[model samples]
Target: MENNRYNNFWRRLAPSVGLFFLAPLVGEYLLGNISIKDIWALPFLAPMYGGGALLIREVTRRAGRGWPTLILLGIAYGLLEAGLIDQSLFNPSFEDHVLQDVAYIPALGVSAYNALAFIVGHAVWSIGTPIAIIETLVPARRTTPWLGKVGLLVTAVMYIAGSVFVFRDLQREEQFLASTPQLIVVSTMAVALIGISFAVGRKPQPKIDRQTPNPWIVGTLSFVISSLFFGATENWVGVAFKLLLLALMTAVIIRWSRCQGWGIPHRLALAGGALMTYAWGGFVLTILLGRSETIHLVGNAIFAFGAIVLLIIAARKTHDM
Candidate 1:
């Protein structure tokens, strides 16, 4: 009984784990050097902290339909950073486009990057969240469903579209002046479409047990401690942040899996965590490699291959269950 309670405690603590850890990490990364909008983005991804929590909370309950919010947050951030803000910060240019004149009121001083951030965020979101919602709507049964696959495809398309916009806009500022609306309009349309669906078929929200110890309590404390370790000033001192994050994430994944005992969703989370770790680790390795001239392609291949093999094994087990 004690073990069950201990297990339940861990189960409850899962969602807030990322938020609590990610905020200070962002602050340390920024060191208070950037604009308020940039600084705002430093923690909890600015304008989207609530959205991030909503995603995490939803995922932990009701088979995780809340992933869409995460995507939306990502899209919102991207639109702000890449589309709107970068107009000046990364690639400065003045466009006399009529729409932008309206977009940037003389008083607001809002950059093109700010206006376009939602596009990137919306695209990233469509990939992860929409599929999650549909799956929650009708989980995988015998029949292969179209909605899940379509959502995933849309994610890829949005990412590509965002990338194209970035590259083209960076090359010619006027192209961006004309293209900005295309990005915002599409993103707004998608949100409006999804909002209608979300409004009606309510996603289930698990109640917090009154007797249960709050998961956020311990999770938040651990996250603060983790951030301090990773948020060190010296680059060398913080080389281990990804490693630490992965270790904690792995522990969380393992505990959640064991607590739930190898069901479909638990196994899926394990796979997702492993993928997250592998992706982060791969990023670290690439940074260490340091240049395209002397890129460590062979080492990357080995890591990728090994991760894929592990993923396949775990997936097989998941299927068997």
Candidate 2:
């Protein structure tokens, strides 16, 4: 009985912990920042990124929403982090970033290009990708809520506390952008986006007679589209083009999903495409890290290969289902 109880405790805790690692591990460490190597940072980061991911996932799932609604919420999360917490979008010299002026708007006091890329990064890679990968790993719990009411309250508190902590840290590193008016505007917009997601939650998918495409095709398209999204944010014009591309791709996916035979395979493919970006980007970004050059690059390459294999296996399993 003790053993069974122990196992149940672990079962209940696993999702939150798994999600916690996903944010720092994949989003920060694997992506290039090596600070996550410090054990002390885990306490702080786990609540920030991990807590945010859990909050987004739980809120959407508990509300009975599907992937689309979850993605929208994830977008809101991204905006909140970039716009409010870090203010990277509005900071002209954020961390002395390379493209600080890429799409600088003097009047609005924001980088249009960076704003779009960062928000999309958090939405798809940081939040959505981890949720998909973790759910794939635990297929039995894929559609189910991972926490009860008490657990949710705890997670929310952690998230809010982490957000305040990050805001203070970022405040010291750089002077904040445009302050009150911008804060109010972005906050309002983020809330509105979240409201929209809830409003459209879990509606029944439309039906059609068209056959679903091959999983490989879906994955490849996802990879290509996502790559475009990642690379196309150097300037205002590119930002505009990328937005149009995103809208078109979204429309295509919605239309295709409504057709006959769409299922887990297609869904996994779309997710795999986005996941692949991180895999390869991990390898490329290793060069920019500026230390242990060959070794870091090789490690990133290995991680990328392993991720591809895992994704392939997941695709196969989805196909069987």
- The model with the greatest lDDT is 2
**lDDT for each residue of candidate 2 in 194-213, tens digit (9 for 90 to 100):** 98998883568669887878
Regions of model 2 farther than 4 Å from truth: 33-43, 175-178, 288-292, 316-320
Please give the CA lDDT of all the candidate structures.
0.37, 0.78
Residue 28's lDDT in candidate 1: 21
Candidate 1 per-residue lDDT over residues 128-198, each given as its tens digit: 32222223222332113222334334434543454455456455654434245545754575556445434
Instruction: Superpose all Cα atoms of candidate 1 onto the true structure and report the RMSD in Å to 1 decimal.
Output: 18.1
Off by over 4 Å in 1: 1-74, 81-290, 293-295, 306-310
Q: How many residue pairs clash in each candidate?
A: 17, 0
